[model samples]
Target: MRFVQVAQHADDLKRAAAFYAALFDVEPAALFDPPGLLFFDVGGVRLLLEKGAPSSLLYFEVADLHGTVAALRSRGVKIVQDPQLIYTHDDNTLGPSNSEEWMAFIEDSESNTVGLVSHTLAAGD
Candidate 1:
């Protein structure tokens, strides 16, 4: 099975759409005028934007979580959670023992909790 579409709710269609456009670096694939739904193609996955508050968090994979968060911060994106180690591996996953997983979060214009994450095989302090 494959996941084709995921949705997020936003009270302000224009603001949310702008934010997503800036984030994805592309205009929405389709826009519905009446209910004000905007859809963006995210690496083959369809991200549907609708009206209301987001029901859950959306985590976007990033090559550099810290750098991405910093860049987004400079662009006026609200960072709810700073970059930090969210998990660590004891076995050899990325490197030897002590490999870490990092994550950070930002609140979207539509009050959605969006996250950025990175996983590497390097040992962390």
Candidate 2:
């Protein structure tokens, strides 16, 4: 089954909305004016943010983690962890050994951490 929605908590909705709008460059599909909440359509998934302590970190998959990282870096997004192999499925995986299961992380405006994941093998892998 496909994931339809994911949520992230934000103590300040206005700030959260601004941070996400710039990062995604997309207007939220749904929003609440006060006590705020915002939702951005990430592909088909609705990324929801509510007023509260930050929720668990979300990991978004990317075709090219390195390229994605570079773009985010240019936008001044803080890289929490450089992309590396987070796992390797021996029998079943989309890529060759050594480079499968790659990931990287960055911090958002609300100090919420988000990650980028990929299945492609890196150069040296």
Candidate 3:
């Protein structure tokens, strides 16, 4: 089987929608207010923001982790952790070999911690 949707806790659909739209730079794909459900497409994966869902720690891959963090901070988003080099992939298992992985954490509108990640070629590669 393949992945389809990820459910994230959202008490206020509109607020969550706005936050995610700014973060992803995309509008919500669909929203059903009767049952309190909102959706966004993230790299073909359905991100479901529902009132009944539990808080989930989500990680998103970004082109520039540091830049994204800075932009979010400027937008008044709470920064949980500054960008830092997290790992260097020496084998092509979790990520490309010889690539450096950088990550940062930020608090979402729903008070959930979200992670941003970026990968780049090692120095002198």
| Leading candidate by TM-score | 3
Put down candidate 1 lDDT per residue, 72-99, tens digits, no spaces.
Answer: 9999999999999877878776534666
- Which runs in model 3 stand beyond 4 Å of their true positions? none
Superposition error at 121 for model 2 (Å): 4.1
TM-score ranking from best candidate downward: 3, 1, 2
User: Which prediction has the highest lDDT against the true structure?
Assistant: 3
TM-scores of the models, in the given order?
0.84, 0.77, 0.97
- lDDT string, candidate 3, 34-82, tens digits: 9899999999999999989999999999998888998999999999999
- TM-score, model 1 to reference: 0.84
Q: Model 2: per-residue lDDT, tens digit, 6-86?
A: 789887777888888877778778887775768899989989898763577898778888988899999788999989877
Worst 10 residues of 1 by lDDT: 91-100
Prediction 2 TM-score vs. true: 0.77
Assess each prediction's global lDDT (C-alpha) against the native. 0.83, 0.81, 0.94
Instruction: Show pairs that collide, candidate 2.
Output: none
Better TM-score candidate (2, 3): 3
Q: In model 3, state the lDDT of residue 12.
A: 90
Name the regions of candidate 1 deviating beyond 4 angstroms.
52-54, 90-99
Model 1: lDDT of residue 77:
93
Q: What ranges in model 2 sit over 4 Å off?
A: 93-99, 121-125
